[model samples]
Target: MSHVANIMLSVDPDDRPTVESLSRWLQTSAPLRGHGPGATGRVGPLGGTTGEDTRRGDGGFPERDVYAGALDHADLDELIAHVERLAWRQPEFVHLFVTDQEQSSFRVWRFHGPKLRQISPEGREEEVRPAGGPPDIHTRFALAGDVELLRDMVVAAVNWGPGPAAPREAVLSDPRNAHYVDGWPRPGDLGLVALATREVDRWEPAPVGAAWLRHFTEDDPGYGFVGDDVPELSIGVDAAQRGRGTGTALIRRLLRTAREAGIERVSLSVGRDNPAVGLYTREGFRLHGRDEGEDSLTMVVHLR
Candidate 1:
């Protein structure tokens, strides 16, 4: 699971001082902790195939210095966000390039405060969703009256992302899925809803995601049922609400709640192709088994 990733960053010449500081910190930070001999660093005008054409088309931005290094995927993600934050704080724009060990997939990002976005190879721009949850996001216990909300979230969870979602009725009508939300908030059912505010002064926040637990008997085990005693997790964040760490926050908090409730373990199922598997893995969920007759995996996390 610890794959290496190469990161390249281009920042305005005026920000060289900041880049230098960041370089010094990177050499000794938690990011490079377990790597054998640490990493190498070099500051120069942006080179490489990906940067050459783009830098040429950048007009009069001048030849900004670039910083490049490689690190473990987990630490790479953290380092990328840290670099993005530094870019956001800079007086001008910054460009970040990330690629896997084989250099097969390249992602480009531009950081400019409230205008952050990722640039595709085709020159298409899309909003960049950071990993950590923002300050405006709030979490609250899911109430019984939130059935409709949970239903919608269930659909989002099933689809995982932008793929076509089954009609709400059809999705919930299935006995398996229905058990997740039907008779919401039954005794021993625990859950939380995450709400986010678009504006700082906004008094009310819109619900963006939810996570809940349901118990099952051995005779009728859930898709990810590990034992009759372990609660199966059902979680989903609105499509528009993902990538901001809302799902992560919800899962982490819900797991803590489970531990406090005397539960020793939690279980869940995710599709083999679902990107959320990475998130779940990072949250300490380990593969238990393949769900029979399904293209999904059953995962479990020990709370004790």
Candidate 2:
């Protein structure tokens, strides 16, 4: 079988040097790193089919130009790092897609946005490290100690309160709050956390994010609660580490955890104003309904 990585690189009109330098680098380096053809392989973008025109000016990005092409999975990250070094600003627009065409699937390694495959260039394959890389985190089961960690993540979820978040004390005040995080990681409750370190992980050496499910009941439904079987999800990334791909990593890991646990579906409630809605949508969560308050929307993802 064949596995191809189709990348879409874009930047604003009056772009920065990181972008210009990236264009220059790709012009020279892609040829060196790419395989199978002269330029990009046959899957190059032709028209609007590849989401080339999907531009949103919400996050401070005004306009964008796309660099779309397909390459072997091996060359994907080098191209992505070129985009990521420009992303520290968390600008409104910077998008990329690394797609596997065989499954009609693609993962946005950066959309100003959000990794895998090594970062080796053609010859000195082992020398270079991943650029704009995945956070140095490992996924692990939620331990009993995660209660405190979950408390912080809950605050992190709502931009750390003083505004949109619910009272922190209330979220973890009682056992009835189990749907969210009061008594997290219950019997059927599967959770995964992203652990990192200051010295090695580029951040604090601690658990920074988590994704877990709690099967809710008819009388005690979660905010995004659907039913008893469809466990509601509560996921949050560290406030200090929002834009650097930690959220994406945690979700991907939790999805794998869900599949292994024989889970059939998961649900979550997200606010319309949350930036994470983009991340959740990208990771396959879809709309179910809006809350009575209308400030939030319920989303669900079916696991296979």
Candidate 3:
């Protein structure tokens, strides 16, 4: 199959050195073309599709540019190497995400002068890694020792977003949401934390995501609660660590744990527009119901 790379760069409009450097790289290095100001809807880097107009302002930056093209395997390698070299020389201003057509490969190299590191799905930065391998992503049963960690993850999970995030205080203050972590591991609470292994400078594994089950009384049912015997689910994954299958892994493992513990089903309430809706569906969750005027979905998966 043909290989293609879609590269997006967020750059300051006034930074002539970086601009010229990018122009020169496109002109001399690979099969890709740089599309910036006035370069609207031109041929996409991956070809066929129209390119997104990057001339418009984005996230406080006046402009961002895209470089895309189909390349032979060798040329794709050279292009990636070229980007790494540029980042090595100018790490401060280099913010890039490069991925292939199939999205089976991605690169967002972290550079420290001459040194280069890759951010694994688990969030650790490792030096000079290869393109593809099973991610170091793994999970462990959360313990009583992780009370503080779970509390922090509760916030992380609630505030997780690719769009507007609710204020932390607002999320925690809600009675419906507060029950997830308020009691500090109630009698039936069980959870697993997805860890990315370790940080570049620290020895402890960093928590990137979490999934847990908790029982609710019929009088105070969770938003997704179906019955007093069914445990409601709560999950959150780090914003940076998402889209790499960490959430899926967490859900699959957590469901297995629920089944092993003699639980027959688990349920969760999620916003309709959340990206994870597709993920939940793929993992066997089916819509249970939705309350009137509510924008969220109540979904359930049978573990029996």
Candidate 4:
């Protein structure tokens, strides 16, 4: 059997130090030629198809495609454009390994025809179709709890992994949310719960709803609500008040707010085994995903 190999180094325009470092590393690690500073060079065995044959000296390894050194913002844009051009010009190059020393993240993207596929470190695979649109990236939060919750979240996060899964426990222990002290909202309990972009225009709260807000304020005090582009809906009721329907009312208020703002969808995470899951489901929330450590279900509701 005969195989061909080609190695290419793509660098950002602003990172000269990285280019120099990589050049030295490649020189010592493999057979390569030194080009000028911040320049690409090629190295290879004379002529061999398979890597095994190249190792045996039947032929040398493949030549590398050298481009400019590390990239900057402008260079990154140029590089992406160049890659897209290559995809159109030469469709045979299927595998691309991208390393960003600037960002300290490495990604391997595979091209099949016009489609790109990203394989996550967790072994999840997501596809990017060229015709449909650009690639989509997401930020994932791990919900941790005790041993039992962790075990459940892990099973739900991925189907397989060793050890107990405790995403919430791990998160709470990380000293980030550790300083969180539970208490009642004093006189200045007037904190803002910024609505998400989708919720901003839809729902309106009645002045009388202030009394209803007491449930979320009194029980889930302390953590001021998040104010990001994607608003998180989190509600908690006092342990003693569990069966009294406080949670249900709080969610109803939130849904009302979302609807008033013209937001059609809302989502939240609750432990899978928790009774709250049933409440959400009964109220028209559908399970979207699961987190084991929190033993939670990521649920979403859509209002017409």
Segments of candidate 3 deviating more than 4 angstroms = 1-134, 198-203, 290-293
Each model's lDDT? 0.70, 0.60, 0.62, 0.36
- Greater TM-score among 2 and 4 belongs to 2
Per-candidate total of colliding backbone pairs: 0, 6, 3, 31
Tens digit of per-residue lDDT, candidate 3, span 138-218: 566676666666666667766655667778778788887788878767799998777663334142346777788999988
TM, every model? 0.55, 0.52, 0.53, 0.28
Runs of candidate 4 with Cα error greater than 4 angstroms are 1-230, 289-294
Candidate 1 minimal-lDDT segment of 10 residues: 122-131
- Residues 1-304 of candidate 1: C-alpha lDDT, one tens digit per residue: 3345677777766777777666665655535312334533322222233334445554643466677766442244456566656643463568777764423456787754555466754333211122255554656678887888988888887776556768877888888888888888788799888876454323335788889998988887788888878899999887777887888888877887789789999999899889999999999999996456778999999999
RMSD of each: 17.8, 18.0, 18.2, 19.7
lDDT of 3: 0.62
Best by TM-score: 1
The candidate, 1 or 4, that scores higher on lDDT is 1
Best-first order by TM-score: 1, 3, 2, 4
Residue pairs with backbone overlap in model 3: 45-68, 45-69, 122-196
Instruction: Report the candidate with higher lDDT, 2 versus 3.
Output: 3
